[model samples]
Target: MKRKLCVAPSFNCDDDMEELNVAALSSRKESVAPLTAERDGTLFRHSLSYPLALVLRLRVLQIVCGISTLVMGSVAFIEERQKFNMGLGIPAGGFSILAAAVSIHTSRGWSLVTGGASVGAGAAGVLWIASGCLLIALIVQSCRTILDPSGLDNGDGEAIEDYRPSPRDLIVIACVQIVLAASTLFSAVVCARIDCTA
Candidate 1:
């Protein structure tokens, strides 16, 4: 009598072994997990550079302009003898301080709205000859920055680079400054005439 060993087919054995291997692989993949946290951290670090630099520059510009306005407005208020001049100067100083604070708080970035308004108010508050001169200087410097043609980027062939003011904006600012200067001068003349009449 010949005894034969009962065994499953070789194909079934191979199939079972393949299924076990696949299950093991799936479990291993689940355990190994992806490095999403590390990848996201690196991505955030890389992306923050440009925006941070821009914010820093904007804050610096805002602070400088704001301080200038405050100082000029205060000087005018102190130096002017007339109540009207004092009134103008006080508001100018207050607006300057407010603009600076808003610029620092808001992340929308600096623009002519805040800086221009401060400068315009400060210019309007010009009561003394020294403040007038300073106002003129500030206007010229701001116009230069606004009109700088080289501010456009040539490297990447982009239409514009950084934040350069438009020609229209410069023209509007110039007009406002001119009007403020004229008004200030007129006020000075009127005051002088009143003194003469008195």
Candidate 2:
């Protein structure tokens, strides 16, 4: 009877050991699952920072370009109306001013409101790209005007006079437009990358 009791106790102990091993394996799986999920979440969230940074950089450059254009346009309008290329200056200055304003608002996390509706990030990005394209076209036009020898003369049969865009001024305008174009292009690329990732 004592030998029978000892054998029964040994069988119970083997059962308990198997149960413990199963429990440990389940616990390990649960722990590893959460850890991998957390890592994946962090990676996805942080992956956007690179493109976002570029967008912000583009905004900053837009702001600077806007300010410069506004100032230059104001000066041309006030002091050099006769010599200023109104066709080029007006559009470039106007675009810059608008771009700066919108970029500033967007950078501050404000959404565009139309008919009491707010725009989404995707829509905003699309609008930004479109604006960038128009700005590039303006920049190209301005560059051509600067490079063309007969760009400064008024079309109403005006004689050559002291009031003319100096070579230095033309060069400066060309350079600024070039920089603006480059910045806009870079931002467009970043924005495109964001779209692709999405």
Q: Which candidate has the top score in TM-score?
A: 2
lDDT (tens digit, per residue) of candidate 1 on 8-85:
766777889999999999988776666543455323233332243444454454345445455544543333322232
What is the Å distance of residue 70 in model 2 from its true position? 3.7
Query: Against the hidden reference, what TM-scores do the models get?
Result: 0.29, 0.49
- Model 2 lDDT per residue over 17-55, tens place: 999999999999998998887764233334433344455
lDDT at 52, model 1? 33
Q: What's model 1's lDDT at 97?
A: 40
Tell me how far candidate 1 lies from the true structure as C-alpha RMSD in angstroms: 21.6
lDDT against the true structure, each candidate:
0.43, 0.54
Candidate 1 residue pairs in backbone clash: none
Clashes of 1: 0
